[model samples]
Target: MTESSPTVWGVGTTRTLRAHWALAEAGVAYETKPIQSRSGETQTDGYAALNPKQKIPFLEHGDVKISESYAIVDYVFEVFGGDRVYRPATSAERAASNEWCSTILMELDAHTLYVMRRHGDLKDLYGAAPAAIDAAKEYFTKLADAMVMKLPAGPTCLLSEKISVADILLMSCLDWAVLYQVPVPEAYGDYRKRMSERPAYQQAFDFNFEVLGVTHKDLPR
Candidate 1:
């Protein structure tokens, strides 16, 4: 990799997909260093030195290292997007993008979808909790209802006419929800279908599967 090339340190997961989608949308030339959690690659001392938290999808740009998917996506947009379609233009647009992304990450992805995964598909790794799973399902249903209300009248984008980080973030999370069998609101079905057709999203999906040695069918759909 060149000195100017950014590197992403994970693959397969939606969190990593967020980084890839943002970079692709911004037309950033980047490299991937696939670290498989299933193989314990993230637990090693080498990876730990890069991120003490030992999380997947950490980003390295020059000497700067950033962990967490949302932060990485925002950093990519600010540093590389500029006037690109991935970065919002006006203050209202920026706020809308932030609101959508934050809501998806916190209210849906982290609290609900992930909780469902922990208890459902990833029970072996995280230990299953029936009550937690049930509660998460209930909470996720409510959140999905809210998402349905916020969804723009779109064949174009989420916050605006142009695609932004909010769309990327929401699409990634919704894909996760689909894979994990979490209930997605019917209103979002069309939005998901539309965003899934994006070239950037397709490229990111291909890269993710190629690096992780998994196919679409291999995921929990």
Candidate 2:
């Protein structure tokens, strides 16, 4: 750790994956506080102040404490995000970036989390719902098809050029999906392979698995 390193309080399996990868991309120094909230420590009084939702991925930049994955990423981009090239250099590019990021959350992550929170190994951490699990898997199949068509490629999409927060968000969700054993539609196989090939993606994936203590059977709760 150094004076420039940002201090981040991250819980297991949280969106901190995105923040961690972003820091790595920006070549920024940072420390992980590891809230260790596996037993609900985040609900405790002290930790609650850092996040209204008592969530993981709370970041402390000097005196400026922040919460939420997107907000934290936006802040990082605004301050230490360097030249706009990493995300979008112009208004239209940024808008496109936002579109891709939204697609990851609204379509990809939502459905995947449902499966994890319902079936898979998440029951050990947050209980289970079979219906939710089924629906989640079902939903993701559609998303996979849509992604296969859009596929975040070409000069306009995030993966087409340089990796961006959009790629980080999508890749993080896909990594979780693999751990959960949710069927990855055949269409997404190529996309997954592309993301896996990136060095930054690999770094984040290894760190996430190591920190979460996961094997093939484990899914983040």
Please report the candidate that would top TM-score against the real structure.
1
lDDT of 2 by residue, 1-221 (tens): 87767987774573777777677666677888776545577888888877788877888887888887877776776677676326576888778778778877877776566455646566876676777777787787667667666665443424446666777777677776766676776756666666566565456545655755753234322
172: Cα error in model 1, Å: 0.9
What are the per-residue Cα lDDT tens digits for candidate 1 across 25-105?
888889988886567899999999899999878999989999988899888888888776756668987787778877888
**Alpha-carbon lDDT of model 1:** 0.81
Summing lDDT over every window of 10 consecutive residues in candidate 2, give the lowest-scoring window: 212-221
Model 2 clashing residue pairs (backbone): none
RMSD, every candidate, angstroms: 2.4, 3.9
- lDDT to native, each model: 0.81, 0.68
Stretch of 10 with least lDDT, candidate 1: 212-221
Q: What is the RMSD, in Å, between candidate 2 and the native fold over all Cα?
A: 3.9
